[model samples]
Target: MSDVTVPPAPEGLPYVSVVVPVHNDTARLRLCLQALAAQDYPADRFEVWVVDNNSDDDPRPALPEDERFQLLRERRRGSYAARNRALPHARGEVFAFTDSDCLPHPDWLSSGVRALLREPRPDAVGGAIRIFFDHGTVPTSGPEHFEAINEFRQRKYVEEWSFAATANLFVDAPVLSRLGGFDATLQSGGDLDFGTRLGRAGGRLIYDDDTVVDHPARSTWRELGRKTVRVANGIADRSAHLGRRDALARAVNEGSGAVTIWLKVWRRNEPAPRRAVEKVRYAAAFAYVRLLRTGVHLGRFTRGR
Candidate 1:
């Protein structure tokens, strides 16, 4: 990891609210909080709000005991809902969001704030994400390798689709409030939906490559499959809102796109002979994930019908 130095904020720097929603992830949340505490940004200029989203385990103890770090509880089941619950209470001009399982670089907040203050300021900004596997150089499992490769495509989401993952997004407070926050009903894809809405409303969303966070790769196929289904369901839910014709059109588009992705994965060549086995493993994992996603989408379509 490259070293990040956060310089002192200029006078009149905007106060930032860093919001994180957590479910039953105590250990990972602690690590995330520790990283936040180590941020080189002016300590008094930023605050952290950790919303416990109906976690069975108490997350309070895991959080740092600092006035800047406040813990809020949201009885609602979804992360988006938790974020909504805390949105009204945020006392900052900018809102920086990240997942509890992510470890952000020390300069993450500083960079995001700077991006938001640029001349042609954007309504929202998304940062880069890097995946780290528990098992050193090679991934320990198929799901791990798959996640390592595809976890957060921040650049593509921002440039191509005008969306960004909430895992590392920064938004101006007024724009976020005006947009009425994320769709609370969504379990996944809420960030995408929010960004899309913002763009449609004449808001600009930019991608800043400097702000960075590290996310651990998913370790099991079951976990990966569950996430895949949740994401597919979120996408389907959005399509279903547009009526039957739109839903059908989305299905057709996605189906063709999936086929193209599969073909690319199958034909990808690994020039290094020693890493050939690793390449095969990645291809199989990618194919499996694509198939699972297709099945999940099909199930959603059937249920919608």
Candidate 2:
């Protein structure tokens, strides 16, 4: 397939619009753009939009000079907010979302479009995310890795997921508009919140392994810990909006999972006792977040007045 050239959008919207939010990371951004440009999907059937979220290093020059591709600028710091801004400008039946850090397979867009066009017309579709790590890095493992392992193990849940990751997810434009786009306040779990709302509203979400992306898990243990904290914050922020009964159930499940992780850490054989200690510390950090749901609920109750 020839590189997808930017052409004037036809008289009507196309089948798919690939929307990406980019900030900094010019190198990875360039790679992402190039991969999109090389997509095997029919040029006219799909479009690409990159919302540059106030990045100091611009990534336009690296992309093809085709007009079919749009490089817009938004000063917002939040990825979901940037996505909201771009949605109004999109002209496609389906909205496909992915992150700038991910590199999609050539058939990704084609596969996603096909999945949505399935007999019943799935309301949403998600592709698998395979993690790649830097070579020669210390072979040490951390709590975050274990959590990510859980996520990987749960990838099958995507076929029937109430939550979806924006990194490799797609949705029908009308349904997305009805949901009011992505939630702006969430720093990390906005995708999950969006998917949950859609699913609860009778939308169908399907997982397609054929459409895949390469996700590089860069950053050290400290960075991973910080990320876990941000994820916990997102959970807290979205708890009330998730409905009271659901929120309570989720809190209980998270608490149980945390305990299970700690027990596993204690029982596992470790060459050094410090490894066990570190796991306990990380597990506690996550457990404390399980209890933070009370604060989130209190805030919601006070705001209801």
* lDDT leader: 1
Candidate 2: worst 10 consecutive residues by lDDT? Answer: 136-145
Q: CA lDDT of 194 in candidate 2?
A: 85
Best by TM-score: 1
In the predicted model 1, the residue pairs found to clash are none
Question: What is candidate 2's lDDT per residue for 1-305, written digit by digit as tens?
Answer: 11333354455334677888988877897788788888988777777888988888977876678776888787767788878877877777788999898899898888877778788778888878877655532223443343444444326657555666788988888889889898876677788788788888998888878778877664355555556556665765656566656655655666676566566656656221256555665555445444454444444445541
Off by over 4 Å in 2: 1-14, 136-144, 152-161, 240-262, 266-305
Give one digit per residue, the lDDT tens place, for model 1 in 232-271. Answer: 7777776766665665565666566545544455453622
Cα TM-score per model: 0.87, 0.74
Model 1 ranges off by over 4 Å: 1-10, 137-140, 241-274
